[model samples]
Target: MFLSMSFRLRTEVEALNMVEAMGAYSRHRTVSLLKPRGDGKGYRLVIAPAVSGQAIAFGYMKSLVELAQQKNLPICDQCRNYESKGGFVKHGTDTSGDLENLVRSCIVEDVTGFMIAKAEVRRTSAIQFSYMTPDIDSSDVAIDPQFHVRAAKPGEKPQPFQVESGTAIYVLGVALDIDKIGVVPDSNGKPKIVVANRAERVKTAIQAIAHLLEGLSFGAKKARYLPVYDVVGAVAAISHPVPFMVSPARISKDMDYVTKTVLRASNYVKLFSDAKETIKLFYMDKENVVGEVKAENIDITKADNVSELVLKIIEVIEKSLRD
Candidate 1:
């Protein structure tokens, strides 16, 4: 069974990945839209699944180490030997390599790993996520204008240039699958446990996703704030394996669709309690978090008390686990 997570996204002037300058007419160069296909044309609406997955993985690994220390777990001195003159542990094992290093048998990089085998490179990733699909009216997308000022050198005035900025409102649907991925075969060709301490590793990752996204800026400029508003999720289990995608047209503040999705997921969980994975839908609206939902879960109560994004995410994750 494949566990899935669906979510929403709203961005403002956050150039995630920059494309080549469209036309360097003005001094300030313009970044293409999310798609960035041609000189000025590709009306990209969604954040690529690859980019989002990398971001999530990076944050998850980073937070895993920090959280481990907070919990008083013994961290390897070699792993923490980050300040040595050795260039990125030139005299040490790659800390980023999940299998090569260890934190109480927990891979710092979690389920993602790299190995060189018989002159052939092998890589593995357990958690997978999909591109965030947007729900905006295509006609509503238009090229907008923004200004950038070059730093003045010596006696030169700060050159001001006009770069084309894109303004878009999209409703995104994202999917996540947390199943165990490929395993490495050991001597005699038996699958060894390449992924160590999975439950703890995954828990840390989920915590990072919930708390770190707002504080850590993704995609483009960090100087300018990229707005992330009202992010939430609908997590549950699944019965029959089926590909699910939400229409972009339903990306409004309305919770009707979201409610139905949650109910469906709940039904699926009830029907398929023995299934290996669950279903998750992450929507970016608070209006849907209604009706005794929080009242039913104590973890959610704590989340509500703190109003932290991480807690809110935990609420959804815990709900999914229970289902």
Candidate 2:
């Protein structure tokens, strides 16, 4: 007679070996972690993705402690020496606020049915869903050859600078233009972040710079503004609604694209502005404009609201007496 016998693994034995066999067992585990599935004696715990090791250990300890307490088992000795033994003690142990740590017991079941057979362990804080859109546009941006403000070395067609919709552009080197809201120049010379929305302010600052560049190019030196305006026209001509729609994941990508485009545009404008400033400084012998050009004086106070941002660009120009 040939007889095959199976040995049922004890809960204590399994707990003892959990740390040792984790690597080997994790490979076969399907990771279908769910709510605790058993009672005091025997229960199944489902492991979920993104669940940290600490959390799992806590879950395991909690169920085990509950079972021990039900059986009237003594946990004091283990609880007392936990700090030295590298074990955890649950809260309400001594009420010293040092017991937030969890206590878990090792448990295993055999194929044979036992009391409270096929029980389950319970847990909380499962997967979460996000309502707002993600901010990265994965398709529109690439990792290679970082976008540059200046043209790529000769023979390269300027790479398409695509951006996601709802992406905002900002002005570079224009932080200095912010009006201090009735404050004279402070000793430190650094702009403060009181009521102004820093990020939106950056965008407004860039617009100010753009208007400043326009005024510099057209007013003092006529030809300097022409090249840059032509560049702007070229960009606008090819401009197409970002190749894709907006989503949370794609928003970030689109933001980067838009940022790069805005930066490049601002840089081009700066190049022309700087060239004119230099030409005026050296050949024309003219002083730098002081919030000078009527167009460059962006009323940050007036642009404090949404209606101002959307409709006031035209109002700004129409209101200007020089134009």
Candidate 3:
């Protein structure tokens, strides 16, 4: 099974992901993209603050650690400690020459994948994350620096610093290959199910995603710069045998992302007639942000919140596994 998700995150005064610190100034990650001009004549470059995919993946792995513990699944010591300095997992040297043992020992490594330099072995992660960036089609994105001074002791000079904060309707896209969890390709490139409890691991992976979004868990510097955010809207799709991605949400003149995704998926389903019965789409439109949409060949269910949307999808996935 393949699962794809896209959601709009509205964060204000957030220093979620930071890059290198120049002197006393901490920089927030930013990216430049070409957007259509208002005059419809040409495209203009826009620089917007962003949260890196690595940072987001770390947050998801944290959730995976916690959930795996609760479900009594396998996890490595390095991941259990929630290490963030060098990398999320222990270095590949620790698990050299044995892909089965590496996956068998840690659920995070199995799902997120790892590379062993000395052994020349690499396992591609089953889950993928796109940078949390502002929607190119929207104009309601801005990032600014906030200045602060460290408190001074008696007769001591105060230290000043600057940190960048961003507020925008950010877009996040995530994809997970459910069939890859607890399964690894062997020496001869044949896929093998390494873990005995593959189904539970798959469910745990899905729940971890729900946990990440429900708690708004991804980001940094929450102690002082907690963001005021909301899941304005989202769309998710599940398809078997063939992968399908829903259109990402955007705040353009016409906010019909949900409709567009459904139409696109409908066309895809028609083209792949065998997958028509196995494909499903779910969406949540808070405050009626996404107006009515009409499509065919697939059913679009409206969920109350992130949890409900994920739960409904989980049901479908679980059923597919049984078949």
Those runs of model 1 whose alpha carbons end farther than 4 Å from true positions after fitting are 1-3, 21-108, 115-121, 137-143, 155-157, 162-198, 225-228, 232-256, 259-284, 287-323
Candidate 2: where is the Cα deviation over 4 Å?
A: 1-250, 254-258, 274-306, 320-322
Model 3 per-residue lDDT tens digits across residues 1-323: 79999988777889999897456889889999778888989999989999999989988988998899998899888778755445574556654557788788898988898888888777899999999999879646778989999899999999899998998888899999998888887779888999988888888898998888778678889999989988878899998779988898875675578978888888888888865445689998885767787676687788988889899988888888888
Q: lDDT for each of the candidates?
A: 0.41, 0.23, 0.84
The prediction achieving the highest TM-score against the true structure is 3
lDDT of 1 by residue, 1-323 (tens): 23344444444444433344444332212222354334566565542211344544444445545666776544454334433533112223342433433322433423444343443443454444433333343324434446767799998998776544444443333333343322345568775544444445445555544443444433344455344444443332222344343323243344444555555555555555655324444433453444343211111221221125345555555454456
TM-score of 3: 0.93
For all predictions, the C-alpha RMSD in Å is 7.9, 31.0, 2.0
Rank order (by lDDT, best first):
3, 1, 2
Q: Tens digits of per-residue lDDT for model 2 on 72-105?
A: 4334454334447565432223323211111112
Listed per model in order, the count of residue pairs whose N, CA or C atoms clash below 3 Å is: 10, 29, 0
| Greater-lDDT candidate between 1 and 3 | 3
Worst 10 residues of 1 by lDDT: 294-303
Assess candidate 2 and give its lDDT.
Answer: 0.23
Candidate 3 lDDT:
0.84
Q: 13 in model 2: Cα distance from truth in Å?
A: 57
Which candidate do you rate higher for TM-score, 2 or 3? 3
The lDDT leader among the candidates is 3
